[model samples]
Target: MKAIVIGAGMGGASAGIALRNFGWQTEIYEAVAQVKPVGAAISIWPNGVKCLNFLGLQRQIKAIGGDMASMAYQDYQSGQILTRFPLRPLVDRVGEFPYPTARAELQSMLLDEFGRGRVFLNKRLIQLEDNGSQVTAGFADGSTATGDLLIGADGTHSMVRRHVLGHDVKRRYAGYVNWNGLVEIDEAIAPANQWTTFVGQGKRVSLMPVAGRRFYYFFDVPLPTGLKQSRDTSRKDLKRYFTGWCAPVQRLIEQLDPMATNRVEIHDIEPFSTLVRGRVALLGDAAHSTTPDIGQGGCAAMEDAVVLSLSLRAHSLGVEDALRRYQESRVERVTSLVLKARKRCDVTHGKDPLATRQWYHSLEHETGEHILNGMAETILGGPL
Candidate 1:
């Protein structure tokens, strides 16, 4: 069998690798003239790690990933640690420690594994056609590819998703602006192996370890959508928004290179009832885009890749049947996650002031185990 994978991102590349493992020929089409990582870093939780292991990229992921051993939540202004917890218990329970990896390194590893020749650049998908037995993709560059199945991994603003639903699905703004980038690891800011976060006033500043003695950091402010943001004024903007934040946050803003930081207005789509139509199926953010509140966005994408491959392997019925099986298996799980993340986003960002204050109070009184158990619930629910 043959498959056409759209978008050469985390989901698309993993789908290509997984399908190939099952003896299917696959080609990945990317929209950009040159491939680049969209963000600074990503958290691959235990479930995501298990999917990578299944794809035979465990060694590569570990090589390019961070050693995250603990987590901490602190008051944004005072820098007082509200709670601190060792992640060892969660790691032991899930059988894998979550790795915070540089986006560039992780993308490079997946592309290398998928093989450069199998991935075509500058092929923006303009249209798709499915005629029961075979599916075809039309590119903006006036090129076309036909295969037995099509997997749309094109991200939140996905064209492929539009074709499947026969309508444009509006993306919901998560009511925040985010600035993220890489900075040299400094213990004065946080521990070398801890994921530290500071929260207050509907805002957040976080730093997590990544490879090569560096920290992947991000700042979140609950701002109105469509607010003007300029790269030239990024540092100034962050400084203004985080004026009363802790010393570590100030240091982060001062130390970061504005030119290198990525500013994103966060958005997510409501979960769809179906992710498949005939031989075409959606994967990753293309299937279910969610806010990063719970940190499972990429992990869910990896899960999709594995489940799609498994459905194909198990169902000898046909391409459409296999796609339907994949959809049925994923819709509930991904919907729950998307809704959960949305709720978490509201709580953390002060959309629900009562919930946000309650969460802070809970954190202060929390033992390490409660936090770890919550994470474990998400990690253990994976199809792996």
Candidate 2:
């Protein structure tokens, strides 16, 4: 069988790899001429790690990923630890390790594994047409490909999704803007094996180690919609916004290269009842975009790849049946997760000061075991 996958991001590449592993010929297309990963760090929890393991990438990811032993929440101004949640117990319970990895590194690995020949760049999808027996994808460069199946793994602003759903969908903002960058890790600032966050006043500064003794740090601030910033002014804005933060955070901000920092307004899509129509199916952010508060966006995409492959294998001779099964299997799980992540984002941003204060105090009283169980709930519930 032949499959055409739109969007060569992690989800699309993984879909191509998974389909190929199941003995299907898969071709992946990317709109961008050259892929440049924008996100700084990705927390690949055990669930996501398991998906990579299914793709035979666990060992390679571990080699390039950083180990996070524990997580701590601190006061942004005084740098006093509000609570410390150890993660080693979760590893023992789940029988899988969670690692933080650079987005570029992971993307490069997926590309290498998926075979570069199978991936086509500069192929922006313009339309998708599904006849009774087959589907065809139209590209902006006047190229077309017909296949038995089409996978829309394109991201939040997915063209494939727009085509499949037969309408344009607007992304809903998650009520905050985030600034992300990778900076040199210093032992004096924080320990390497810890995911540390400084929180206060409806804002947060977080840092986690990646490979090569570098930390992927991000700042989240509640801001108005449609706000824009240039590179030079964005750096200055970061400094001004975080003036009262801890010394380590201030130092980290100062060390960041103005041109290297990336500022983005976080957004997610509303839940859809289904992810498929005929031979076309949506996966990852294209299917159900979620806020990054829980770090499950990419992880969910990876899970979609595995489950969709399983469905195809089950209905090898029935492409439409496979798509129906894919939608039936994934819609409920991903929709609930999308809503959960949205709630988490709301709590983190704390649009209401009083509620936010209460939320922080509640975190102070949370036991390590409670936190571990919460993490376990998210990771252990994923598809095997």
How high is each candidate's TM-score?
Answer: 0.99, 0.97
Q: Where's the lowest-lDDT run of ten residues in candidate 1? A: 224-233
Off by over 4 Å in 2: none
> What's the lDDT of the predicted structure labeled candidate 1?
0.93
Of the candidates shown, which would achieve the greatest TM-score relative to the real structure?
1
> Tens-digit lDDT track for model 1 on 1-384?
999999999999999999999999999999998999989999999999999999999899999889998899999989999999889989899899799999999999999999999999999998899988889999998999999999999999888888889899999999999899999998888999999999999889999999999999999999998877878889999999999889988988989989999999999998888799888999999999999889999999999999999999999888898889999999999999999899889988999888899999998998888878878998888998
Q: Best candidate, lDDT-wise?
A: 1
Note the residue pairs that clash in candidate 2: none
Task: List, residue by residue over 1-384, the lDDT tens digit for candidate 2.
Answer: 899999888899899999999999999989999987758878888999999999989789898788789888888888888889778899999888888899999999999999998899999888789996899999999999999999998899888787677888888988899988888887666788899989988899898989989998899999888876867787789888888888888888878887888888999989987689899999999999999988899999999999999999987569899889889898888997899888878878986778888878876786677768877888877897
- Candidate 2 positional error at 68, Å: 0.5
Q: How many Å off is the CA of 198 in candidate 1? A: 0.9
> Where in model 1 is the C-alpha error above 4 Å?
none
